[model samples]
Target: MNAIQFGEPVSGKTVSARVSPAGGLDILSRNEVARLRDASGSGLHQLLRRCALAVLTSGNLSDEPGTIFEQYPDFDIQVLQEDRGIKIELKNAPEQAFVDGRIIRGINELLVAVVRDIVYISTQLESGGFDLDETVGITHAVFEILRNSRILRPQVDPNLVVCWGGHSISRDEYEYTKRVGYQLGLRGMDICTGCGPGAMKGPMKGATIAHAKQRRKGNRYIGITEPGIIAAESPNPIVNNLVIMPDIEKRLEAFVRLGHGIIVFPGGVGTAEEILYMLGLLLLPQNQEIPFPLIFTGPQQSAAYFEQIDRFLRLCLGDEVSRHYRIIIDDPAAVAHAMVSGIDKVRNHRLDNKDAFFFNWALDIPLPFQQPFRPTHEAMASLALHRDRPRHELAADLRRAFSGIVAGNVKEDGVRAIAEHGPFVIDGEADVMRALDDLLKAFVAQHRMKLPGGTAYEPCYVVRT
Candidate 1:
């Protein structure tokens, strides 16, 4: 690969080069190549370009997608099909993605993942390869996407732990997440997350040291993201294995299906959305028997955060929702121990049910949780957030409410929608709306809604009784 310096006066230094696929997407059909190269109103090139930029800009802190695009407006990528293999051409790309005119190896692999998933989803999944209407079909599609990424192992025991939390968090909370990760890593556990900074990076960072001390080989630090959220939360530098699902619902599904346990830290609406999604599934009658481990933890200072979450869950879904998870405060060792013990139970449960260790096929996720939610103003306004619905149903709608808030806060389309329209109007039962308003007020006051030190946050949604 050679860097071709261009004469473009830009804010940051840009590089142009052609790099071959490191270990993915080595071969593609003529049609596939054409689809990737097609730069029209109806093609995959724009999507490919956006995702590729996100991979190249790994470790970026900005949650706004437009900022990155505006910074590198001249940046472009082209997929060149050749008999030997495929070559990706970068133009005016982020200079940080390269060193001394050579692309970073990890970044290169992740870039290839961008190309692979974008092409595969555009050609295969969206083209009748999977029946997305059925719940089983959706689960199968998630499994296939993960399987294609080659992260799933057939002979491994249950050790993967998924960590969820806000990208914006306190230094103390971040350190606590790392400590918990250190303990988990010393016990030979792998880590998976949304693949951004803050809590997501902390566990992987701490685990690296522990993994080295224990001489653990082939350790996986996986990051799963969707197109809508990837630009806002680029895969952190520690993410060795990154998979881009088609959307948020599938992304969340992949997390639960692939992970043996989960640890949730203090976070904002996005984190709450993840918690509710998991709880919604667990509340289902069929999932009651499954041995899945869920834990909510943080530093002592953040105890009230989890308490508020607990209260909101109870208020929205009833007291029974508390049975599905345990809260541990300021005890990383205990958190790791609980996860280790819980994973053992998960292993036995899978074996008893004749399920695969790499993927939890026996977990019953209802269609509501599997379906992708498009959070338009009308859709957000019409959510069935009343307590009269079933607990699972209410949890699903509540999850959607938070999901829409996340979109408005970060995702490109949602931000644009909020700009064109006003804040999303969320109406529910009087008590539920009051509880939600209180919880959201706490999040805003704690600076959980956006990266700390940014300008004061404006509400993205109005909760109405």
Candidate 2:
């Protein structure tokens, strides 16, 4: 219930100094620095500091953001304005972020992304420049965020595979993901992920070797994350391109838009939320014809986990829901082969439909799935999880339910809220609740709820069956 503890030992640590931006973020307006320095009640300074710390502490194996802050309570980052550009000053950052007193190149790039996203969001809100109330407006905001991050490639083919799974996966599952990544990479496909550890890192790590073997040049290992979950799931070191969306909604949207095919590794509620979100979108009549290749895969040991997920999906969304994705068990080569083939179909479909290869413009995402779902006590209780509504609509609510659990499990604010206000009461149809409870119980029982070496797992949500 208290602030979740985090970070490794800091004993025998000393201060370090870093120079100009590593990923080409060398300029920021005076206004941006002012906002970043404003640690007051309504300021962005605190958020900036927390996110910056997460980047500097990249490759952290911890899932508790509170622990990171607790370990470095005195850690402070300052945005210094210079005539030519901006310079970030760290008061007590992690020594691991630096080598020979110089900030690591990748970490510096991630740090700039934090500053870039924070400033951009602050500017949008202050100027009333972004219309986030409507579905289209929200999508536009997501697009602009991606564009500003320079992640939208203009001419690249649709080869980016978004690998979604838990950060606390078992070693076998993690190794399996790398093999799949290696296969995908050898065939010239790129990797995109939530940008954390476990499954997220495995694929990127594997691809590096495969790319080297193939003599592939200019490979992109993109890591997309959001502020709320960034600290808990720090960016892994393998991510060459990192972009931080403002929230989970935008992060999910970025994945669905940027990825040609999706490969789901064994995961917990967070992964379920992602699967539900994508399925909910595909279930819509408008998106039924879209050629989006989605596969649920893992090593032989993880077959049961995906089987449980498949059964849960069938029960909640009906047998027809299985049509949206394929399940590949234990075969890394086959999973990669399927993904490569699926991406080819996606390419042809996009070309025929005149959709952008960089972003899937043909796939239509409805308002419910695009808008941010705030996981407050009231909001969580008010979710329409019953089966009376359209199947896609029900899936949206189900996604929200899982999203709330993910927040409570890791997000700092969500964790604090659950601590103060008991567990979140997720009410729904009796049958649906039974299936939901069963799936979540499996997650807890299998030690998938948190990192393996951390504290014992506890349910943050309560299913009112």
In model 1, which regions exceed 4 Å deviation? 1-11
- Residue 253: error of model 1 in Å? 0.4
TM-score of each: 0.96, 0.96
- What lDDT would each prediction earn against the true structure? 0.90, 0.86
lDDT of 2: 0.86
lDDT digits (tens) for residues 194-240 of candidate 1: 99888888899889999999999999999999999888788887888
RMSD of each: 4.7, 2.8
The deviation in Å at residue 392 for candidate 1 is 0.3
lDDT by residue for model 2 over 1-465, one digit each (tens)? Answer: 011122354342535464577764767787778888999988899999889888888766678858788777888888888876677888878888888888888888888888888898789878987888887777788888888888888888888999999887777888888899999988898999999888888899899999999999989999999989888988888888888887888889989988999999988999999999999999999888898999999988888999999999999899999999999999888999999999999989988888899887777887777788899999999988888889999999999999999999999899999999989999989999998999999998777788866568778889987
Judge candidate 1 at residue 356 and give its lDDT.
98
